[model samples]
Target: MKLQLRLSEWQLTQLRQQEQNLQEEETYLVTALNERRLPMGSSSESIARRLTTTGAGVRAVQAQASRQLDQVRAENRRVKHLEQIARAAAAARLRDAEARALEEMTNLHAGRRDRTATTGWLDSKE
Candidate 1:
């Protein structure tokens, strides 16, 4: 279980990093597209074709970045779920250990001269 959790966490980290990179790539593409200047001597038909192609490229990058972001969110959710389960399991183990220790202490003190300690005076009806 611990190993699985660690692996998932590592995967989540990798996914986030990948998503960041994609976002950076998208940003750069958008910036480049925005800053583009029409060539001074270009024919209008060529200029229109160039604008169409760059617009399509920017749209494709945006779509890919969004998809990567979704994957990162999913992985993040998985890591959080695994962490919650690990915490609950640890809590259960701790409770079990405490119960066992209490039982052992009771057994150890049973032979003592103190009767109240054995009978659990704290549990008395009074």
Candidate 2:
């Protein structure tokens, strides 16, 4: 048995939307972390512990989101690289075709140089 899996255009669009959401969430988390770092004045031990736990949870999420973003960026780089390679190959093929056409034209004109022999004769007479 063989299996092939690929995302449809709609699915790809959805994935892009999800990626944007993740980026937004990560940004919000970082902003929240920054805001929470300031002195909140002396509080009871339970409140302090809750704040600490919340902070730790935010940090973990930030780390995971950052990692996921890194992965997405890496995949984008790879896709871009493959696109570049394909473009270069296409350009190379075009160049090769043009070169062949030029070579063929040159060969076709090779036998027409006999007209220059008249000029040589005129030069000798002068």
Candidate 3:
């Protein structure tokens, strides 16, 4: 018996969205960091001042997004791991069932053979 891994449509969609959001946020962080590294000037000071005011908030958002991404990845891994275990268990059950069936077939054949031998002995005596 082949066991298939099944994921709900919503779960797949959510995972995709989470991945996309993480990528986008990572890009935004890189851009912001680059902007902050430019040569300091009066023009840059205004931008720097604004960045300084909102930097903590931006950092917090990035951290939260990263944490969420990690959580989603962990969940996906957990689900896949569980699926592997289920497949292995199903395979084991199938093998057990086949063994039992073979044992029963062998016992049935042996019983028939014994009956035939007994009948043959009685016929010879007669």
**Candidate number achieving the greatest TM-score relative to the actual structure:** 3
Local distance difference test, each candidate: 0.66, 0.60, 0.65
Pitting candidate 1 against candidate 3, the one with the higher lDDT is 1
lDDT of 3 at 11: 47
As for candidate 3, its clashing pairs are: none
Q: Over the full model, what C-alpha lDDT does candidate 3 score relative to the true structure?
A: 0.65
Which stretches in model 3 have alpha-carbon errors above 4 Å?
A: 1-54
| Clashing pairs in model 2, backbone N/Cα/C closer than 3 A | none
lDDT of 1 at 43: 55
Better of 1 and 3 by TM-score: 3
User: Which candidate leads the pack in lDDT?
Assistant: 1
Off by over 4 Å in 2: 1-53, 111-126
Candidate 1, run of 10 with poorest lDDT: 30-39
- lDDT string for model 1 (18-100, tens) is 65665565555455546664346665566556556656665665666566666656766777888899999999999999999
Pairing residues by index, what is the TM-score of model 2? 0.45
Candidate order by TM-score, decreasing, is 3, 1, 2
lDDT of 3 by residue, 1-126 (tens): 112113333444555565566556555545655766543453555545655645555565566656656656666677788889999999999999999999999999999999999999999999
